[model samples]
Target: MIAFASFAQPPQDAIFPRHHPDVVDDMDVDLGEDDFERGYQRLTCPGEPITSSQAFMRGHGTYVDNEEVIASVAGTIERVNKLVTVRAVRSRYNPEVGDLVVGRITEVQPRRWKVDANSRQDAVLMLSSVNLPGGVQRRKLESDELQMRTFFEDGDLLVAEVQAFFADGAMSLHTRSLRYGKLRNGQLVTVPPALIRRLKSHFISLPCGVDLILGLNGYIWVSKHMSQSQQEGDAFDGEAVYSNRNDEIDGATRIAISRVSNIIRVFGAHFIPLTDTLLLEAYEWAVEQEGDVRDLLQEDVGDALVATVTAHN
Candidate 1:
């Protein structure tokens, strides 16, 4: 009774273990040989240790704890030089300067309009940043302020660029260029911001007479393709840039737009990053299947579409 039984304590390593030794310190972890050959990105979850903090700098979606860089979100791990960051699997748009975005006007202010660009806060599009109806180089005047709605009213959709940022981190948008202006004759498709890949041109024309504006903000514009002349602002009056009327789209073009839009939705559901090449291939594959446009949304069809498109890649 006087002698008490003593219990051995667990080893220090067992009490507070580090990440698995197999987890590489670099951006990529070696999955098995097969996966490694595929060049699969390293995926991480919250609280998972990425690497020793002393060996690397932490970036967004990651935090340092106990001298180790840990993922603060579930995403793909990326490394740039000595900095490590996790790109979230799904998240709202994070605006950057010079990015092309599709947004809806939420509120019209005195000299600026608040745009919902799928960001943390509404983006601002100033009156001075837009091309006047009369001329691109025309200076902003008092009349433009009173007729702001004529340019962009509440809930009107537009395509613009990220010009700058405010002290509060809100984005400032500009539609000064001919390519950027009111969106018309199109339907909008929304997907996870992470799925839209950056390319030389976000505007894509499919072979099926469909045009796509793959906004970096995750708002896509799918519409009937316009000819080179129509796309160039010089072909018509500058007022055409802000025209709200839809150009009479034919039945065939409407069907094409619907098919492409559905294909994109399917891909988004499967969490596939979209590219122009992939969209073209997927469109062809969908047509070859001879299924109705709505059929693409069927789980089985969607899976097959994704599988087929990915196999080619």
Candidate 2:
């Protein structure tokens, strides 16, 4: 057995030097004045103390603890008056009053239909809220309840606005206006809800003969182009508005619709915000490609398309 020599230990002061508490805290939490001025800056995280509770009140996505305003979710900080809120970068749809949404009927109940609007709970669409086929002022009879499926059945998609809320916090939707009704002559495309920015008009008509409905819930409807006048004209034809039948879509219109849908898919993939001008620019560039609608899905083509659109934006 080999014998080991004993050595004196170094002084604790020299071996482990003490650091100032302020220095350590400063090193742990970096708060710079320039952090706020940066464009679209999101420099916050969950459980991170933002400021003293006495100075700022906690708001959504944040909580108060030990006289400190701390975030409850990872997101950027927002300030309104004395209230501080952290808006999560990615979250489920939080419906607000009068917000338009596109949803699919999940269940057909006695007088209300359960709709999936990408929310935590299924939304409620009552029979009384919908415009009957015969006319807008038509009364709902027990016979109407029997034929509720005729107006809205399971798996049928429609667009409507958030009218009210149920006792349990579920959304109540309404389709009293002609603009809100059964969806046809188009296909649904879903994206991250954050990408669908609030615009003056969610109903967009592309010059390529396609109509796009940008739902706040991120469900986009791409269909054959229709003018507002045409939409108004069809409002009287309740059969057409509520009809499950799709209007005749010509071959050219079909290709245009497919191309527009593909462009949107590409934009969503790249995490780009959808806007009327951006879409118009993208569509114009896509048409210039002289390629088939399916070509946009190719890796090189998709990347190039995104690059082109983003460059212009």
Q: Which structure among the candidates has the greatest TM-score?
A: 2
Error of 2 at 10 (Å): 48
Local error of candidate 1 at 10, Å?
39
Question: lDDT tens string, model 1, 225-248?
Answer: 887777774324856777788999
Clashing residue pairs in candidate 2 are: none
Judged by whole-model lDDT over C-alpha atoms, candidate 1 comes out at 0.86
State each candidate's clash count.
0, 0
Instruction: Give TM-scores for every candidate, taking all chains together and pairing residue i with residue i.
Output: 0.83, 0.86
Q: Which stretches of candidate 1 lie over 4 Å from their true place?
A: 1-40, 233-238
Candidate 2 C-alpha lDDT tens digits along 105-189: 9999888999999987999999999987745686788998998988888999999999999788899999998788899999899
- Alpha-carbon RMSD of each model: 11.2, 11.5
Candidate 1: give the clashing pairs.
none
